[model samples]
Target chain A: MADWVDACATDDIEEEDVIRFDHGSRTFIIVRDHEDNYYCTDGLCTHEEVHLSDGLVVEATIECPKHSSIFDCTNGEVETPPACENLHTYPTKVENGRVFVEI
Target chain B: MPRDYDLLGADAKSAVANGLVTEDWYRTHLDRKTMKALMKRADQPAIWDTVVLFGSMIAFAGAAIALMPSWWSVPFWLSYGVLYGSAMDSRWHECGHGTAFKTRWMNRAVYQVACFCMIRDPHCWKFSHARHHSDTVIVGRDPEVAIMRPVVVVRMAANLVGLTDMWDGLKRMIRHTGGRILPDEADYMDPVFFAKTIRTARVWIVIYAATLAAALLLQSWIPVLLIGLPRLYGCWHMVLCGWLQHGGLADNVLDHRLNSRTVYLNPISRFIYWNMNYHVEHHMFPLVPYNKLPDLHEACKFDFPAPNTSFFDAYTEMLPALWRQRKDPDFHIRRQLPDTANPYHDGPARAAA
Candidate 1:
């Protein structure tokens, strides 16, 4: 069981904002949804390698910046073409106003 | 008189022989009227396009030789890197569409010559490029888009690690043409291949090999610069132009028209590349000669695909916008959705019939 690594402060990302955080060989996109829930998913589009952090954060979904493939930030399901695979999500927790994600 | 009915049949047959048009296309697009028009335009380069191509290549080649002395003997590589490589992408592009000549053999002949001179295999390119036109920027199935993805990735990665021209080419060719991308077990349908593929590959190898051998015998770095460096640069330019013109943009529906692209209007970009930046018009009517693209784009601005906001604007933002466009992917073959299921998703239009 990997322990949560404190990724960023709640203030690090605003609602409708996505940022890239590298964890080993894998990269994760930390997106703050409209409801202020912080979700983490694979940072790269599965179909193509465009970074998820660079996408448009719309409500609960993040649209990839390159080809507009949508991904659910909540569970990482692919919502469009080009990308057929679901993005992998990391368990996220907020403690003491700081965001932490389990790699 | 009467437009040579036998010649039309022969031309269509030849186009089929070269894999320029599928049987269905022959039946659908090449009717008597269309065939007559296609013949009228065949094998004869539009005076304007020919002048632009030849003049651009010569001027650029001369400038490159003066500037990069090592590139003198094979200056075509440098000029091609600029003029033909980028702008004139549609010269061979037209050949792929089988509109370069009324006679299929003549078109194939011109394409082969152009491909060899340009160090590209028109036949091989046609196999992939034709699919590109048919499929558009479909991520997995479209080979051209698939081929370009890694390069786009690396370019984005450029901030972290620098990319040389050769490294870029290697990455692209490996993904696109290299057998690694092939699915297990070949799906063989048509047994015959266009002469442009294998023949062009062989000639390219021979010429390049002989050039290398001579360079080695003479013990001069000139060969490395002439044949090698420009190819590296030329191929990179080719891939970039091809990639940006369609791949980076959101895919356009088959019917609504695709967005045309324009780059920095460097003289090199224009003269050498043959105004292919007017891509929307080119794709809309593939048979329209390249020389006529600009006028067409300008005249029919409302009908053609919208030009990108600005390639420079996109450049400044870098790959983010391009990457963002991924979610809204578009395919070339426009279907009415639920009427006739997208052939791109369902599979080839004709399933081994």
Candidate 2:
């Protein structure tokens, strides 16, 4: 059973930016790509559990700010290491002026 | 009876019991926008530096070989040695972080070259250094702690010319060529890189053997001097710079301000060192590119210890402290932070957060 939760306003995240979103005990990030499409993924890097919200999003990839591990923002697949695990990507949809993620 | 630094020994267990394993060291607060800008990767600066590094090496080596049998060739070989031995260390570091270039493969290529030049095993050192950043100088966990407590004078002295490091590195290479992950290395490194580490070792064996064969067959010191010997002859600068990093510094601490040093260096040394004289800033923010470290230092200097302005100041502060530690392993020089800076420890403010 998936529940769609409102993350934030579409304007809240600028182009090529990520913002942290917390629901209950779990944390995820709402990422806005260069094309204004919004995506959602686990908020922490799988490598060392550092917050991925602190990471840099370039093109379609998000790089871990600590160790420079890279991951694709869309499907959450790791593009580089010391991180061998893929990020868990959530389904995202923009509703009116707000962004909603299926969790 | 001083502290032990063995990674798998009793000190390691004590470090874990004491909560020094993977600690969240203090980070000076920088807003998202500023941090993002500082962490942004660029290819141009590294590209330019790499071009000059290789270009000068080529020019010097060419001149040295052409002017062989003359004392005039000594200067050329010396210059080439520094470029090969010392400069490659910084390259190995920055590229290992994958922050030297925006392109992934570019970083990998340079990292491989620098690792070879520095006589370091790539995958093994990559994991070791990652642990280094994580633990800094924690006695039992960090493998890259330079000049560990109760420092061995002979080891440090021999490392000045890259003697012990190269010798130990050769041994490791041969061990890895046996297709076995070292027992200590297996402690932290993921097994995914095992095959690559072995393959790299095999490749290195072939290259070194070829170089040796060339020198033997040609009846000349040229090939050996150009290839295998620069690492030994030119490693002085690397060891010099590396010693000041955590020498006489606190161990088992979560604060890099306590463990790392920031020194002022000359233009040529800075160029060769890739501005790693701003080492505290690099440890605090490991992802920041080497080119942007000076700026990071400027932004964060207020909340940190003052920089050492000369090698005299650095060595004078470090050597005596290290000497004292020879007898009293607990003795270390603690730098005072400015009043305006936030304490990087779990003080009242951090406890509240």
Query: Candidate 1, after superposition: displacement of residue B32 in Å?
Result: 13
Per-model clash counts, in order, read 27, 0
Tell me, by DockQ, which candidate is best: 2
lDDT of 1 by residue, B1-353 (tens): 01111212443243334333321211012222332232234345544556666676666656655665453545555554544433334566665555554445654665665554444445445555544554354333244442232234555434122134345434433343332322200111112343323344555666768888988998865555445445445544555555456544433123213222444445455455555666655554454555555555555443333354555653544355456443422212221222222222222222321
Can you tell me which runs of candidate 2 are displaced by over 4 Å? B346-353
Off by over 4 Å in 1: A1-103, B1-80, B100-106, B117-119, B146-152, B155-189, B194-200, B235-240, B251-268, B313-319, B323-353
- Second chain only: TM-score per model? 0.60, 0.96
Task: State the weakest 10-residue window (summed lDDT) of model 2 chain A.
Answer: A59-68
User: Alpha-carbon error at B134 in model 1, in Å?
Assistant: 1.6
The TM-score leader among the candidates is 2
| Per-candidate DockQ vs. reference | 0.01, 0.65
- DockQ for candidate 2: 0.65
Judged by DockQ cut-offs, the docking class of candidate 1 is incorrect
Across residues A9-60, which tens digit of lDDT does each residue of candidate 1 receive?
Answer: 8988876677889877878888898899999888888754766665556678
